[model samples]
Target: MGLAKVSSFLLVILFLINGGSSTTFTIVNQCNYTVWPGLLSGAGTAPLPTTGFQLSSSESRLISIPAAWSGRIWGRTLCNQNETTGRFTCVTGDCASSQIECSGAGAIPPATLAEFTLNGAENLDFYDVSLVDGYNLPMTIVPNGGANGVGKCNTAGCAADLNGVCPEQLKVTVEAAGTTGVACKSACEAFGTPEFCCSGAFGTPDTCKPSEYAVFFKNACPTAYSYAYDDGTSTFTCSGADYVITFCPSVSSI
Candidate 1:
């Protein structure tokens, strides 16, 4: 029995030495907000991805701590606004124009506004989306064939657009961050691809953030790139079109 106990203790030590150790951590945005891509940096100049992990609104992410990650938790929040959900929206807050590209994607862009800051035991970052529906012009341009291009939004933050004007402003708010207390509503499980509608304001849905990218645009004409919309009545252009954005707690990996 003593030999068996000794064997078990040695096994545990081996596991620890093999770098199979794990830690469960939680960053509660007790402020009634959502901290996106909540980056975590520990013991180094750069932060690490809390990846291969799953997290719940109230749950923590289980991460495999690397031996090389020794610095302390050092990371900043980085977010910018992008694209319209698919509704009738445009500049000047006008919803009466069919020419205006709209979206039903419910996202309040600037999702958790408080402006760029770091989030760590030493620093709790804050952000607020200030991207209004306008242009997106990134200093570093990467054209997607057509007018589709990356740009900055009003010198404030990053944004996506069809051209000239943004499909809609990427709104960022500054309210305390909090969880919906619910998981992402099961991918709209009712009928055809779920379709969210807008109440008033800009005739668009407040599609929340971490705006994903599209694999193909409805159209792209060398100098122009646009996304599909409204049963195909019009397409968003990415020519002079751009949405600019400014973010702090700067992300080196944007």
Candidate 2:
């Protein structure tokens, strides 16, 4: 196609050359089920969805295209469904197909990897592919065993995996992967412990915003700290392995 400009929601700087570079996009799966093909996003006056790529468990696949692509990419992991059967689903059982169906017999029905943003113009970044079973599922990206990524926005946010750390990349992955090295729940509620920590004994529930915690992480350690999450069922605690012993407002954020 012609010059494919990066979307505005993301931060990128595109350079045009005689023959653009050919970079392979990789998708990794650390979750249970397989993910569908894949989709790409663009703004040729509107956002258009592209086809997807299929990957198996712990599988990695790459896609190479001529046009410069960045920003939000879309797609789903569907089963091998039957189109001729009125309402066809890509999958039903274990049988696998791009958008086809199987005979109620197969390995395992594929799951969906929600749409994620892929911007190459910023610091090089890749997505940590994790198949999800449903909508309410928690993230398998951060503090989990998966890949790392960066936001296309200026808003502050860090990513980690089940490994409890973020990629050491310059851009997408940054210096704030684990601010205090001791990371805690953004919302105790998100961790199903908000009422207790933000509102429980010894703790002042819901009194601290993530930005506040961020300030503490930056000021308390400023350099870097050890990160750990103490998840006790209905109670959650995130702190620096060697630092967090008290809660105080970071003078900066304040």
Candidate 3:
């Protein structure tokens, strides 16, 4: 109503439009080999400058994400680019685009996912390291600064080498090099049964108990999604903090 009040109201409106504060994601490639990190914004969310970029062993990249943004990130491995088409293809976590820039396409399943919904109600950010899709590379999401004021904002991920113990049924292998497994598949992908996928008769949490396969993943990564109904403990929330996403972080780090 008053001129000063009107000015304050306009500022508040501008803040929402511009996103009150930005969060930086420092993606680190700690793997022994090179990896191309892929990023995809959720539907209707603002896109980042580069969808995919190369990261050699021990290299890192810092990306500033706008407030209220939501998206998923993953690492692409064993990649090769076609000089003519300028398209990139990877052994794991390759999106449909088959290029350096994923555009709006998400990674093909059986790839580890670092999912985030930042700056929501009460200035909290909800994030998780999910193997629900499956595990290609080990990943950890660490919150920095005063993000731990609340309870349980701990690091999350599957830091172990799951592929070594991946059951034969759940092993995904590249065609050209079919001897060794490249990624571990979720029970849902390995077998589309209702019980494994939590679909049809097993759609509800009460109906679908964790299977032995899911349990294997759960044991390896207690903080990550082992199956479709892993929300209870898999999802984590933090406030006013940036993030460090590392591929192949030490097991003790989480």
> Over the stretch 151-242, how does candidate 2's per-residue lDDT look in tens digits?
32111111122112312210121154433221122222223344323334324323523333333333332222111121111111111111
lDDT of 3 at 125: 88
Q: Could you give candidate 3's per-residue lDDT for residues 1-254 as a string of tens digits?
A: 99999999999999876777688999999999998999999887888888989999999999999778999999998899989987789888999687778888899988999999987667678899999888998999998874557535778787988877888989888778666888998889888889998999999999998999999999989999898899988998888788999999998897
Deviation of model 2 at 10, angstroms: 32
TM-score of every candidate: 0.23, 0.31, 0.91
Q: How accurate locally is residue 217 in candidate 3, as Cα lDDT from 0 to 100?
A: 93
Model 3 CA lDDT for position 55: 94
- Residue 1 in model 1: shift from native, Å? 2.6
Please give the CA lDDT of all the candidate structures: 0.25, 0.28, 0.88
Ranking by lDDT: 3, 2, 1
The candidate, 1 or 2, that scores higher on lDDT is 2
lDDT of 2 at 175: 50
- Per-candidate clashes come to 67, 36, 0
Judged by whole-model lDDT over C-alpha atoms, candidate 1 comes out at: 0.25
Best-matching candidate per TM-score: 3
